[model samples]
Target chain A: MLLGAWGIALFLAGWEVVGQTGALGMSCPPLSAVLAVLADPARALLFQRALGATLGAVATGYGLGLVFGVVAAAAGHLLPGMRGGLDRTSSVIHAIPSVALAPLLILSLGRQATPAALAGINTYFILYVATSSGLAGTSPVLRDLMSVLGAGRWMRFVRIDLPAALPTLVSGMRMAAPGALIGAIIGEWFGASRGVGVIILNAMQNFQIPLLWSMVLLTVMISLTLFWLLGAMQLGAARRYR
Target chain B: MPTAVRVAGVSKRFRLDGGADFLALDRVSVSIGAGEFVALLGPSGCGKSTLLRLVAALEEPSEGQVTVAGSAPGELARAHRLGVAFQDHALLPWLDVTANIGLPFRVAGRAVDRARVSALIGLVGLAGFEAAKPRQLSGGMRQRVAIARALVLRPDVLLLDEPFGALDAVTRRQMNIELQRIWSEQGTTTLLVTHDVREALFLADRIVVLSPRPGRVARELVVPFARPRDAAVMRTEAFHRLADELTDALGGGA
Candidate 1:
């Protein structure tokens, strides 16, 4: 943890130096300039609206995807016949680039719903793959014990496989958090009226370097915080379940 | 004595990953009477564990049949009348000792019998360690929890597959004595599979010695020691004589 903090400090120092020197060109701004734009009281409402919109999509999509993925994975585990089919379908969905899917989603679901749709799809694929493989990894010895104890299929699933899969599922949730945000941002670029992604698109096109940098920094902060929290949860699950 | 478990003319064959069939047990037969303790003793790879698995309904005999309480092994298991413990102990790492011992009741969809579970915990001398996880305990303690779990439901048949095989010699001997006491109290029919001749002689009412690979019963000896026998019985001249005789039988069959 100390090493990670040191690395982050070093990275921010390097970024500030590059911006101050203007070595990367006029587009790069100093870290102080970006922080100034973020702190300005004049832009608080704008930042709030954008942050709220994007977070709303992320929460909805991530929650729906998690529930769907877990249910699907459980179905595959309980019914061996459905496993091959679920695997193929998830792989096919994940194969198509989200960038390509965004325009199609906008036409069908409209601009307001597009960001959430993309995030849901991205989270679904990741969680489905993680949960299915995790469920498959139940210990052979434990399975034998459950059998000798006369556990039924549902009983074995509840008592053995679910707890066994917890660590991996938590890891999947960590990865999915950042992935959902990325999907929501990409969806916003197509035509959403307000979001961090909209600010980024306009700032880039208008050459508002500080605004662009500030939005990017905020996104990274959100993603990192979520990643760290879930990583802690994964550690706890491994300690208990493994 | 009424037979509680019967492996009649049983044969077991396993299909290896390379597609070749390996015979484990060949036409082996053994009968365990109700309330009797029997040990199937052999060298490593002699298929004694395979016979135990067959009776535990973990595997199907390629030929012949295994029955418990005059019904199929699977039937007894489904009825939640069979208990088992392996060398691995197979305790769930997430559960505490009390929960682990009470797992059979949960599996059988029956109410968790709190009084019975606490009684078995005391019976196995693990009264204070009820809330401890399996990882927090020593190897011997883990096996004690497993034995208590096996006896939790008052199973009609208890199958022990090298339950102490992984323990040190001293711990193994201590466990044998403890097991003898518990078995005497429960009087549950039991079949133990082990490679240790001394363990078989010390714990079993009768010993069935099996040959090395492609296992078949080579000899049977009835233990003459009285009930509630202690560690002192193991030091008797008769015990050593029987152990040596069985050791020779194992060697000769190999």
Candidate 2:
């Protein structure tokens, strides 16, 4: 664990040194410069507003997608005939590039709603796949026990299937966070009202390297933090469920 | 005597890969009187467990019928009258000992009977470990919890499929004695499936030996022992004699 942390620290130091040396052009600013831009009091409100909007979109999409995915997976599990159709539909939706779907989402839901909608779609696909497989992964021995105990379909699902699926479902949530974040950011690029994606895009075109790097670094930190939290949940579920 | 469980000419065939069927059991018939302890003894893969599975309603017979309490095996299960423990124990890892024992009550859509739960916990000697989860318990303790769960509902019939088959020799013997005591108290029409000859002789009122696969009932011996048989009985000459005879039957002897 210490080695991993040390490795990351060294990589960061190397990145800063490389940028400071001007070896990779102005696009690669020193880490200190990006931090300075992020911590600047003059630009505090601008960054805060963009971050707030982005966070709101990500949260909204992630929550909705989780609920939808879990419900759909449960429906498929209970109703066997629905399994095939739901699987194909989810695959089709996932296969359509989010980039290509962005303009269509913007057209239908408008700029303000586009980011959340895209994020939700991305989150939904990952969670659906995870939940379906997790539900199917119930142990054959446990299934026999359930049958012998007079457990009905609904009882079995509630008492065994759902709990058994939790660890895998948490893993899916861990995976979906970055996808949701990326989907929101990409959606914002296609005319969203305001977000970090807009700030990053503006900084890129205007050649404000530090601000661009600051946004990217902030995004990475948030993504990693969320992943870490969900990873803990996955481990907890695994310890209990398995 | 009233028949609590009746297995009449039941045969089971499992389909393997490539459309071939493996005959697991031939025509086998057995009947257990109410409150009797019957053990199906055979070598591993001799379909003794398959016969128990039929009684538990976990499998359908390819031919013939298995009736528990004068109806289909599933009916007894549907009424929550059947209790079972397998080699795997099948305790939900997420639930602690108390909740795992109380699972049958929840499954039956009835309120959790705290009094009965505590009684059975103590019955199986798991009193202080109620809050402990399955993973925290040792093999013997986990199987004890499984037995407690099986008995919590005061089930009409108890079916045990090699419940202590995975335990160490010392633990297995200790478990057998405890199980004999437990069975004596409830006197529930019980069917135990085991490959251990000593386990069968120690706990069963009657031992039904099966031949090698495809399994058929080879011999039956009435255990000539009184209720609540002691561990000392295992060291008896009669016990040794019966054990050898059953062991011979298991070795494919006619």
Candidate 3:
């Protein structure tokens, strides 16, 4: 753990050095200047609003995606007739890259809704695959025991499969955290009213180096924070379930 | 008296990857009377567990039939009147002892009878460990918890497929004694499948030995020991003689 912390610290120091020495172009600003811009009260308000809008999209998309993914997987699992079809359909949907998905989503759902829509779509595939495999991953011995005990389909799902699948499902959620954030930011670039993505794009065009760096750093921090939280949850579930 | 379970000329054939049917059991039959304990003894790959699975409705006979309580095995199971424990304890890792035992009630869509769950926990000698998970318990304790879970619903029939098979010899012997006492108290009609000669001899009222390779019953003997038998019986000359006799019968006369 200490080694990892040292690694990250050293990387940050390298970034600071590269910026301060103007080793890169003028677009590269020192870490201190970015912090200074973020600390300014007026700029802080804009950052706060951008962060809030992006977080709202991420949270909404994540929650809906999680529910839909789990439900779809369960449906396929309990009804074996649907398993092959559902699997094929989900795979085909996932094959379409999210980059290509942005325009279609914007055309259909409009600018503000596209961000959440894309986030949900990105989160869905990860969680669906995780939950499906997790359901199948429970012990055959346990399945036989339940059958002998005369458990109905729903009972087996609720009492056994769901709890057993929790660790894997939480792991998928952790992985989806960053993917969902990226989806939201990319969707924002296609003409959302206000967000960190829009600010970053505008700052880059205007050569506002410190503000652009601050926006990217903020985006990275949010993704890292959500990832860390979900990672901890996944660990807890693993300890409890396994 | 009505028979508790009937395996009427049951046969099981597994389909290999090449689509050829490999016969596991052939024209095997057994009967257990109401409130009786019968052990299906056989060598490994003798399909003894398959026979029990047929009775538990976990498998369909490739030919022939299994009936429990004058109806199909699935009937009794669907009515929430069947209980089973496997070689592995097969306890849900998330649930504590009390909750595991009460799982049957919940699965059966009945209220969780707290008193019955507690009583079974105590009966299994796991009273203090009511809140302990399966992983926290020893092998014997986990088996006991599995047995407790099996009996929680007070099913019409109980199926045990080597319930103590995973334990060490000493722990297995000790668990047999506990099981004997527990069975004497409840008298749940049981079909126990195992490879241990002494285990079948000690716990079963009657022992049916099966031959391997297209499994069939080789021989059967009604145990002459009386009720509530103590471990002292195992030390007797008769117990030794019978154990030796059954062991020899199972030595594959091929």
Candidate 4:
């Protein structure tokens, strides 16, 4: 609660300073003006629609990435030779900037949520590497113990490997959450009819500084909420393990 | 006497990358009788552990056959006839004490018997810690949990690879007593690999001493102590005599 209050205070203070100083060619809008726009129910509906669209794309992409990442990591152990090739390909994908690839994804998927999905493509690789390394990191002592106890391969994986890999997987998911949202917004910026990205683009084209600032605040709120949700999930899983 | 296990001309060779094959165990032969507690005493790298693994079916002998209960060790393991514990408490950290102890039964697709689990927990003196995770327990307690887990299925034969090797001296002594008590109660044929001569003497019905490098049996000493042996047995002349005999058999270096 204290952190939330500090965040609101800092944002308002920054808004006031930028508005008063008129720096950065600023016709900076005050916090009250943004809140007033938010209070307008009809305008609020537009923001809500944009928020919904962005969230939908992010959610879909993140879900797909998470499922595929875990499966790939588990399969990597069953097929050792494939691990190096898959890891190299994932690193290459990670190296490509998501923003630069947004246009290509849009072209391929015909300007739908494909670009956002592309933004989340790297998320799985991060999670896969983390999970696989975590699984591989089972101590030799522990491995010998299990083997001596007559635990089969499946038993070892279920009993030892999965629990050990969970923390890494959760951290990877937390890291990927923001990336998913950013990918969605970048997709919208490149080619989309709706979303905060589209709103910010329009505001810039018309030189509507106050509206652009409002849209930026909305994006920050959305991203923060998504990140907090993922963090909560991580905490819950950790608690369960404890 | 029915032999519970027979390791005839058993040898194990491990090949390193771009290196010559390293012989872990030479052509070794030993037979353990039913319901006997035999300790494999050797120095580090003597392949005592390798021999134990062969008995447990965790590894196959490179040159010879290892049979447990008249069948291959692997078959005995699959039939839930072999149980093992290691020096490291291999309890699943995610599982609580009870769940870990129940694992063998669970693996065999048998329903967990709460009464049996409670009995085993009581046998290990871990009565109130059923819900505690392995990470939450101390090293000794975690090892007790591992021992309980190994015994949960009530296997005919038990294999231990220095199961108390990681504990402090005092705790190791206490655990030795606990192990003897448990073994007497269970009456399962048992094989233990340990570097500690006192521990082997304290717990084993017979001690098998192995020489260093390409491990082979050097001596076999039968322990004539009575059941329910306590830490006080360590202070007896007979105990010291046996320890000296085993120590000399270990070539005064181990």
Residue-wise C-alpha lDDT for candidate 2, range A49-110, written one tens digit per residue: 99999999999999999999989999999999999999999999999998899889988989
DockQ of 2: 0.84
For model 1, what is the alpha-carbon lDDT of residue B79?
89
Worst 10 residues of 3 chain A by lDDT: A25-34
* Candidate 2 clashes between residue pairs 3 or more apart in a chain or in different chains: none
Distance (Å) between predicted and true CA of A186, model 4?
1.4
Identify the runs in model 2 with alpha carbons over 4 angstroms from their true place.
Answer: none
Docking class of 3: high
Provide the fnat value for model 1, as a fraction from 0 to 1.
Answer: 0.84
lDDT of 4 by residue, A1-242 (tens): 99999998997889777766667455676777766666678787898888788878787888888888888888786578888887887788778888777777877776777645764686676777877887787777666656655667887787677777787778788888877777777788876878777888898899887778788888788778877887998887676654
Error of 4 at B175 (Å): 1.5
Which wins on DockQ, candidate 2 or candidate 3? Answer: 3
> Which runs in model 1 stand beyond 4 Å of their true positions?
none
Q: Comparing candidate 1 with candidate 3, which one achieves the higher lDDT? A: 1
Candidate 3 chain B, run of 10 with poorest lDDT: B245-254
Model 3: runs farther than 4 Å from truth?
B252-254
Please give, for residues B1-254, the per-residue lDDT of candidate 3 as tens digits.
57989999988999999999889999998999999999999999999999998999889999998889999999998899998999989999999998899998988898999999999888889989999998899999999999999998888899999999989999999999999999988999999999999999999999999999889999999999988899999999999999999999999555
Cα error, residue A74 of model 4, in Å, equals: 2.4
User: Over the stretch A1-242, how does candidate 1's per-residue lDDT look in tens digits?
Assistant: 99999998998898899999999998888898999999999999999999999999888999988988988999999999999999899889889999888889999999999889888998998899889989999989889888888888899999999999998998899899999999889989999999989999999999998999999999999898989988999899989998
Against the native complex, each candidate's DockQ, computed on alpha carbons, is 0.87, 0.84, 0.89, 0.40
User: Best-fitting candidate, measured by TM-score?
Assistant: 1
By summed lDDT, the worst window of 10 consecutive residues in model 1 chain B runs over B245-254
